[model samples]
Target: MASLAGCLTGEEESENTLEVLHGWTGGDGAEAADALFSAFEEEHSDVDLNNKPIGGGGNENLDQTVSTRLNSGDPPSAFAGWPGSNLEQYDGVLGDIQSDVWEEAGLEDAHVEEAVEACQFDDGYSAVPIGSHRMNDLFYNVGVLEDAGVDPESLDDVDALIDALGTIESETDATPLAMSLEAWAILQTWTVVMLSTQGYDAYMSFIEGDGDESAVRDTFETLEELLSNYINDDAASVGFTEVNQDIMSGDAAFIHEGNWVAGAYINEDLEYGEEWDAIRYPGTEDMYGLHIDSFIYPGDNPSPEATATFLRFAGGETAQVAFNQYKGSIPTRSDVSTEEFNDYLTETIEDFEAASEKPPTLAHGLAVDQSTQSSLEDVLNNNFADPFDVDAATAGFMDAI
Candidate 1:
């Protein structure tokens, strides 16, 4: 079990200890975090860093645990989190790190535009981003596309994509798109559908809470058709990992997911650009849908100096490169080089820079607050997935968000 006691503000037993709560207990996430932790320990040998990893996809369990600790006046010195309004939940407890970390660590100039935007609040900076995951990725199996005589590069728009799905269904035995009906999965696909069909401005308007009802209905209609027609038969029963498996085995042609899916491919020893590939979601080439994993500074900090050291390390170029290599994300620092990463990451780094807009993803708590995320998830997955009700889904989204 992880310790509740935080770092040494000279009052604690472990005077040089620093506790960090994160959700990277297994697989590539764990490996990537271990690399980061090892590097930190190597640099700061005096401080005993308590690495508390709470296992859960999307930090579902970890977030609640951190909240409980913070409420009990036992906040970790630093904790991993998403950027944007997600930080507002812990507003009272989160301390201002603008001068301590942002300015001191040179993050203001080094980090990407979206990272800076997400980290800043009216009062002060809420967090410092460690990595950036592009959420608008459509991954596909190379051999399946080749055998079906369909060119992945030719899919320039939703119409082209729909026609290609038809071509894959008719010409090959592979499933057109691997999917899932798990609430988060449904919400994830729905977000992509909105971007691919409604375009960037419409997607942004919806995320910001003043969505156009007609466009919302239209996006819902498009998602309903895509989920109803092209996805694998077992989509309702499977999840994201299963979908990745289906695509890699050539049983499915495509799966729309975040760049974190790259870690799975890397784990399997699959070659990028040859065995599989990812593209900017059709109709979203100009927009980079981003999901950032960051770290927060808490007000109940046991060791302010220790936490500052940790934050400074996290924001450094060396640490960013080390953490993101296996974490399945690109460095939030734009200065980090792509030569150290795989082809997919290198391309994503370029795409992120060239894109006109880097919009935070909705399902992952980057674009909206935690409440809004839960509301949308419940509204879409429960009302739309099983029933495929566009009117109800649109109505729920229009009201809830």
Candidate 2:
């Protein structure tokens, strides 16, 4: 793992300074970014890479930060973010780098087709995907589950999951589920619940503005049940990292988060499939919730060539493997072998490859535009803050879309 503290060092008056901004402040995310930037700097010593990391709870704050910079006409050379409709917001100021970088690096042929398509818009590619993450994951503390006499494999559906939660709550002192108060965090759990109960197509229909009203109500009711009963008492005050700490300390039993938690566990030297275990978020066995972390070049970049150089390096096989190795994600490029990844990531890749239905993660800016995402987040946050009526919450959610 590399350190971000002293990674940026070069001539003060370097001819080309690539100001790269991203949201990876600590743990494997930061280490992966640092290692990528360090390697790029070593290869291109003449270009000063000013890598700026904007840390927040998750993509919520970082999205606002990057949007502010771009809207203010002071965007960085390139920034890390999600692909798809999220980048469409900056289409006016985003450069089409498919030809300049991806094609130049021969990524069109080497990368995964879905990953390449994620970066592509009506006109051209707006971003370069570095890795792909499975958003629907239920990570558990192996010791805690064993102590509670619960077999995770036997828990396959919502009812079984709830039963397991009750068992853990009764047989042990551990928190049943670990989660954060952040709207996105809450939304992640809710989305999984929705997909589990309503199925992927129904969930997508709701996201697309038409779906069963009963299903929507049921989803909210499920969220209310989980928040009101199953989760940790301090969930409202904790963040994802703190929840991870609770799991590590045996204070919490399971965390419904993305695979990035695996990176944190790996950073702590915890063995995957041993200290911690991962399962598809209940009822999502046939579905793959996708969250892609990618880099986009701002159209107003003063150093386009230098930025292009960095972008090219980021999408290459070596950088993708290096970064995703610690980030707990698989490379977006199919050319990269899974042999270098851990057993957990290998399983994620296999699941990703075999999933019958792959849907964009609602919490991660894949399913909606920025405004809608914010509005939906506000609704979820308000409801979570004070358990709201399912009918009222459903009405509010429909209005948000």
Clashing pairs in 1: none
Q: Against the true structure, what is each candidate's TM-score? A: 0.93, 0.94
List where candidate 2 sits over 4 angstroms from the true fold: 1-15
- Candidate whose TM-score is highest: 2
Candidate 1 segments whose C-alpha is farther than 4 A from its true place: 1-12
Q: Residue 53's C-alpha lDDT in candidate 1?
A: 95
For candidate 2, write residues 1-401 as lDDT tens digits.
Answer: 66432454443333267888888888658888877787788888877778889888776567788889888988788888888777767768887787889788888888877788778875788788899888888999999999999999998888899999999999999999987878888777878999998899888998898867889889988878877888877877878888888887889999988888888887788988788988888888888898888998788676788888988888988788788888988888877788778888888888887989888888877888777888888887766555656777788788887
lDDT scores of the candidates, listed in order = 0.85, 0.83
Clashing pairs in 2: none
Q: What is the lDDT of residue 138 in candidate 2?
A: 91
Clashes of each: 0, 0
